[model samples]
Target chain A: MKAPVAVNGYGTIGKRVAEAIRQMPDLELKGIVKYTPDYSVLVAYRQGIPIYVPKGKEGVFEEVGVKPSGTVDELFGSVSLVVDASPGGKGAQNKRVYVERGLSALFEGGESPDVAEVSFSTLCNYRQALGKKYIRVVSCNTTALLRLICLLDRHIGVRKARAVIVRRASDPKEDKGIVNTVKLDPPSIPSHHAIDVKTVLPDLDIETVALIVPTTLMHVHVVHIQTKRSTSIDEVVETLSSTPRIVVLEGAKIGIDSTSKIVEFARDLGRKRYDIYENVVWRDMIKVNGDELTIVQAVHQEAIVIPENIDAIRAALRLAESAEETMRVTDKVLNVGLQR
Target chain B: MKAPVAVNGYGTIGKRVAEAIRQMPDLELKGIVKYTPDYSVLVAYRQGIPIYVPKGKEGVFEEVGVKPSGTVDELFGSVSLVVDASPGGKGAQNKRVYVERGLSALFEGGESPDVAEVSFSTLCNYRQALGKKYIRVVSCNTTALLRLICLLDRHIGVRKARAVIVRRASDPKEDKGIVNTVKLDPPSIPSHHAIDVKTVLPDLDIETVALIVPTTLMHVHVVHIQTKRSTSIDEVVETLSSTPRIVVLEGAKIGIDSTSKIVEFARDLGRKRYDIYENVVWRDMIKVNGDELTIVQAVHQEAIVIPENIDAIRAALRLAESAEETMRVTDKVLNVGLQR
Candidate 1:
């Protein structure tokens, strides 16, 4: 059985994911990728991991002399499964790039994660990625949607879902320049912009519209969902409250709550390491109306990626006996955060 | 026959609407309402039309100051109907305030024009306003939605509808002030949002979300509709293009044209007096995928409101053979810019 996985792109999410991967017994730190000199990359390098530097912004590591195998025979010739944990939207395309290089591993699909995705929050649909092709890990907001939607999907038959994404203009760290303007992107609605729900159900219909609002850190999604059959919002609340990975928040009864406080709560909650049976869920930003519900949810991107990636390597490469076995391993990793 | 209908809140749209309403044969000018005096008000006043103003905002009129009754009723009571020319969304709460005062006649729900209202936009279930208890005008975006949806309901049978609103932020001259984010409004989804549309269809299942962006003149709505019956998007476009009172422009193969350019074109097309009958139907915005179609549309808030107000007045007071006849009379009393 494979004991270690190499992670490329040691950016914001990559470092933590690298640590979490190292923690898995079925996994080892084969190597780490850093485009240039970064603090954590230097640490990992000193700790005896080979640090690969691929030159240029559009530098696909395969092009450089220190490459990731030229063909499928080459990838299988050296490494195990590759978890390319880079950044947002463009990264999905990057995953496609690696797959083109015979890295036919899957992450999570916003519409349907086809391959082995280490989906966080109850590991919803982790089984679907088993022994599959390419797996696409979703965006942070997409992860929040998976956690919330799976809860609703099982308790109530969720027929259709639509979400509006109000994203940050500048990153909390990326002080590239100064500008402020509310912009709407993909300008078109994405049919699968909803979730990494591929594992649980294929051929699902979830449409999403994303907008980039001027903010930073947490990305807020104003989500409204329609159920197949009508159910009271009271039932909706019960369904949400019962879900461990999801935090069902009640929004301010008067004015709209600021994005500032919502993200803070999610960051604090992520620290909890309770088992799936006893996780805390706060319903502060959840707005419900009959079978139709609207939610304002925020997720700290850094914390979500690591656990998901670890589980991905476990499930995709068949290191775990089954998805349940992978979960037990993921639960133990999550335990590290809870104890702190 | 009803005496002249005085136009209230004569600004960008109100000015043109007042001119249109004044041309009716059965309607005559009673007085005019102004917040801050401008060239338009002075011209209407010079023509012997008494202009009423709110107490403090009224220093411009030199004479015995006719205080604005502090409430809408002070003005609404004397007029046959009040055509609120305030900016879009600006009048929602205000409309609610006056509807609470109760109508002397129907506003539009096919209730009592003598007590309720009968707005323009022949497509809306204005007929329902005939015998209703209260009548309220919907937002301009909703107006465009109703217009486009009616075409779908007739040709394809609407199963579901979704609308995304991109709005202008500041009203440097016309629409002013930060009104705060949309808060605690039930039917947060437009199908359920207010205006009592159920008073008509009773089965209109619509979901709408609003976004505040940076713009001033026009609002754009991206609409996706799923039909019960399968009809090609070409058929849908053909139907929309054929629909009267719609401006369907032809250009571009990629996506619908931008919002600003759409409205400017409409303003130009709207210049033909007969455009009230032959509207520039928005054809460029339509896209078909299997049974689902998506469209990008822009509607001038100015055009939707003042005309509706004028029509509501004509029916509410039972002053004319029809609001159309009244509009013919009102057109002679005022003149504003119209696009060709």
Candidate 2:
């Protein structure tokens, strides 16, 4: 029997995570939590996914011509695991309810590090989260950073690293974005992303500065690292490309030059919501100068962490023994390499 | 007795160069070249600056109710030096005219480095440009990079540096810019900027990757450098702040966070055209870990190089013997420290 799972909060990440759960044969999407009777909830209902509302707020969904599958309390009670994909900062509060009901829960990057026993990235520390009560999946930027940094460190031993993130102001559907402005998010150095990376890869020395641009398509990262050994750009490319969910494309050769182009390429591939579920790295932009390495890549903000969230679900429930095993199952089911 | 200079091509950089030339007591603005009759010419005429039209294009200006002060040939013949502010890629074509007229010319960064005797940034290589027949003022981004890097290097001894430039798509006035996209300008690593910086600081080890974002206000740079010795952030900030055109502002403390806010602050200061001629470094964003340093700064693309252009004019005309002397005269005349 499939492990029944609940996705709390049907928002950007929650909706994507729910669909991912449904795709996995090992997991069953028991229900999704909704606080409002909005158009999104109606669409979710039309898609045949059950909706769960607050115990007293069931009337709101019924008024919108939708019946609640169960109350949020019932969601926690019925499912063995719950993915807290609520809006940022809501996960910490919802953690209390998960503990009260004796359920394993996955919190997103927005929650504090202390909210979970371990901060997780599938490639970096998936095993660290096995059978844990709570797993905090690092943010999109941090996940992207860990994936690349860890890969390089495992092969060449990264001595130190620095990154500058050109972050998108908002997701495409969100209206509140910086228009005609490049904002220094936090207006400080080593923006929260740098600190978040440490939560997963504690020994790796990394510093990051981030700025939010007006674009809503994706976040671009320029990463530099001093490695213990010398490597060629071609060698680095081969290693990074061999990994699953890391698509290395030659920008000059393929005419893929912008974040918008990456999304359109996914659209051309007929991806759902035009989501690029991989780190779209510009192959030619990876420069290796002896022991020093630099890479330029783009992370689709909406989808980069989706697979990690899926990996977290398995690790938290002890569904798989190792990260490799979990990723193999998850990757095959999601068709993660289709874009490559 | 002031050196008479003619500004070739009355466009974005040309008009500003002409006005700056007029302001410097050591230089006189003789005339400005116009390729076609446009509203800009009318404004220049209204400002009482002499407008020189192409020989056959004089009729077009007269038809537009603007009188041409002289032919382009006369403008070239009258001035001792010509500052080529024509559109990008046009500087090479105009080089023949300056040569034919036997006049010294200062080309903007858009022109190839080979077009001039040496590539110049006011602080980095001003003396190299002194009395040179043709001096190419490095691009705005390069000027900003050199200003900070050279300052830090002069004090701490830079071992190597890497920068990821979040470049503004267009000047505020230009209508053609990337919309809703973060474009890799060259779709390649070490985008021409790394090569351009090499033109001036040939021996400095530096790599740069640049992306064009949808912002017209300013270009932001995330710079990382490994110094030969350890230093504190306070020392780096103090050393960089001591420079004439470098303005270090505490972003979080001052409530200045975005490129738009930096431009707005300049406007609040009643700056001409809301131009911030300084490199606006976030005071708290400069981080130091042992010998490695990371800095986040915004370069006002439209105005950051204006002061360098003025300093180049002084250096090229042999009015100043050293970089310090040239900047001293140029900075005082233009009030370069007003933003600081």
Q: Per-prediction DockQ scores?
A: 0.08, 0.86
Every candidate's lDDT: 0.53, 0.87
lDDT of 2 by residue, A113-211 (tens): 999999998888877889998999998999899989888888878898888898999898998989998888777767899899999877777888888
Candidate 2 chain A: worst-modelled 10 consecutive residues by lDDT: A331-340
Write the residue-wise lDDT of candidate 1 on A170-206 in tens digits.
5566775222233335444462454344434445677
Candidate 2 regions exceeding 4 Å error are: none
Across the candidates, what are chain A's individual TM-scores? 0.71, 0.98
Top DockQ hit: 2
Best by TM-score: 2
Clashes of 2: 0
Candidate 1 chain B, poorest ten consecutive residues by summed lDDT = B105-114
